[model samples]
Target: MSEHSYIAGIPLVLGGNVFGWTAKGDGAFAVLDAFYEAGGRMIDTADVYSAWVPGHEGGESEAVIGEWMESRSVRNDMRIHTKTGMLGGAELYEPARVLHSLDASLERLRSDTIDLYYAHKDYPELEIGQIVEAFDGAVQSGKVIALGASNFDAARLGAALDAANATGATPFTALQNEYNLVNREAYGPDLQALAQSRGIAMLPFFGLASGYLTGKYRTEEDFAKSMRGGRAQQLAGGKGPQVLEVMDAVATETGASLSAIALAWLVRQPGIPAPIASARTVDQLNELLEFTQVELSDDQLARLTAAA
Candidate 1:
């Protein structure tokens, strides 16, 4: 569709949430540099990113990316994607508020136009049309080139799309939901049906299951390896280990890292342009970039899917 041209045929979209949080200073720059050098263009981040960390009031990731782009002189060569409406209350979707949020994100990114912007999550208390109109206003003003819905349920996403069509406004061309080998609850049958019917490109987040699928968190002591280790504890106790076993076999057979296998699996799925992932180091980034080269066989893909 003409409306989806902006994000068509895209490669990996390097996530920036870890920039100001886990990957800082030159470490973050190294990862960004590795991604850019590898022909990666799109970078996904959020205004409220890293705010959960004490003393960080959001925009930290954007500032890191902005500084990197300026230092490397690659701002014009990249497609930047960021989100709004997560920090504020329900009224943040108001037209003026949406514009204000866009301006703030623009200032942080040191760019005039955001290639793609997202409503970080839906405010179900408000009307869908009102939210769509507010976001479309940003598009109308030439601020954001495209819009996407993140963390939206199937029913809500359908209504929002319908509302956009009803008003001839800018419809969401992409979706940012959590869909990985193990965590398929958010992008289940109903949401998949809507996405398939509407031809929405899925740019799924947490595609690595927050490092669980990397085969790094096997033992109980492995949980102490990183700041995000605690988050993967639940996955370790249940079906996560089972899924990791499959990924390990695939990795051994393919002579690739588990990280690469995980990402490659997502890239092979239908309707997914690319799965969003972050690398705290250039080594990890290189591993993920390998997904572009690796092609899972039909049996490998089936086993991976069934393991989940």
Candidate 2:
């Protein structure tokens, strides 16, 4: 099996959760266009996106991406990564179910092969062998180029890797987890150590702490800036404001936007190959794109890490 390595140039992975839900079709197309025009290539989405929205059956984001790829005709220049196994209709780790889900994703993305396919989350109930067999089967079928895990803890991830080694199945090459200056517990020492030891690329979701670290939501009233305000609300207390304070200081020192600083910090973190962040508008995307060039100094990183 070919090992999937990390790509440079654009360090941000555009999140597609808002494609058909908040941005709708046209707005999503505009955002995607701006992203690609700015040299952004990696996009992250999932089959279960926007399912929490009322009257939505999911796969809405992938469908929008498919249409966008059709309209833009630049699929060759871009890398698309998506996830399965999170939709609520049924459990997804079963081999038959995993194959069926991937087929559906391919149809929606209008792509023959997914550049990276993630098992949306770990399923401890399913035997480790079962997960490996399912992913190995997908790689063999050419429906997925590589496999990854999202929301996996260190211990479970280790077990999964052991299973892959013993069975000689397709191994996970990447990881997706909630990580940022504010949300650090999930991907802290344990996960960081495991990924570094295994050489698995880390793609941290919520790289901006759901926009809290973006400096757009300073006060409680600023939470109305987006529908995902509840997430920001969670960061308002405790060390959230403290983390933002350090980010603000670093942004000021480096003359970078808070959003850019937040993402740049993730890029500097050990084991992180890229960060998965989202933008609902072209302006928001522009701020995130700044991460491509802004390099955080060791001192700035130290301050942010110490604060967090």
Candidate 3:
């Protein structure tokens, strides 16, 4: 793929899952502006974002992004990546549902075309050829510039690619999965190899392990710092602290923040063009932007990998 085909030059993709949820209204706007001003390009969101929240029917994040893009007049400069599927009562990957979901997402994003559209999860019950045909239909209609898959394993992704190739459909150009310094079981070597061989860009979410790698959740008291405290506590009980220690050393040596080191490690991995991260505040966004300035050494990378 060409550098401009996927999210190139930018080593980070700002996540929109926090928008209209933890970060509301002007807070979301400020964070978006800060990110763009810092040279960030892609913004990842979904149709079901914040739907679990009490009065939300989803599309909250996409609406915020749409408004921000219009008000800032940066719609042309931004690469909007949104997803379908995985919404409550609409998890199937059938053609009619896929097209309906894409139209709704387009309306919410205020864009005639989505730069990259993703299937949020794999529905094993659905036929791979049918799913490919549905997504390819969006591409042919100019509603989507590119296609992607998230939360899909190696076998399923391979099958989808095969189906697309055989049926003359547009194959998924990107893969988004849960991969971080501490959580590597889901996206292991096999998946990485398949994505690399197929030229699919890997943009892993939860790149900072839900803020655990930021070094703020060191102790029990630290867990109170955010709403993800319970998860942080659970991670701290495992190899989370060990990963933090190695990251600390790398940070001390490289003069980069823990978040930057964590993200830098991700961007350096095989087949990974960028990593997805979110900041509820402008300060946090600035910290994440620092990853571009950080370049880990071979020894440092090895030590960090071994530690993890």
> Which RMSD does model 2 reach against the true structure?
2.1
State in Å the error of residue 222, model 2: 1.2
Off by over 4 Å in 2: 1-9
User: Where in model 1 is the C-alpha error above 4 Å?
Assistant: 1-10, 235-237
Local distance difference test scores for all models: 0.87, 0.84, 0.87
C-alpha positional error of residue 153 in candidate 1 after TM-score superposition, expressed in Å: 1.0
- Number of colliding residue pairs in each model: 0, 0, 0
Off by over 4 Å in 3: 1-4, 89-91, 235-237
What TM-score fits each model? Answer: 0.96, 0.95, 0.96
Cα lDDT of model 2 by residue, 1-308, tens digit: 11354343466788988898888767788899998998788889999987889998889999999889978898777788999888853367777888898999999999988888998988777777788888888898977877899988898888889989998898898999988887788887888889989988888888887788888887768897668888887865588888888887888888999988888888888788788888888888898888877888888889988986
With a 3 Å backbone cut-off (N, CA, C), the pairs that clash in candidate 3 are none
Candidate 1 lDDT over residue span 115-154, tens digit each: 9899999899998999899999999999888999999998
lDDT of 3 by residue, 1-308 (tens): 24546474367899999998999989999999988888888999999998989999999999999989989999888889999887843345767777888899888888898999998988777777777888898898878899999998999999999999898899998999998888887689999899889998889998988889899888778888779887767655578878888998899899999999999999889888889999999999999999989989999999888886
Better of 1 and 2 by lDDT: 1
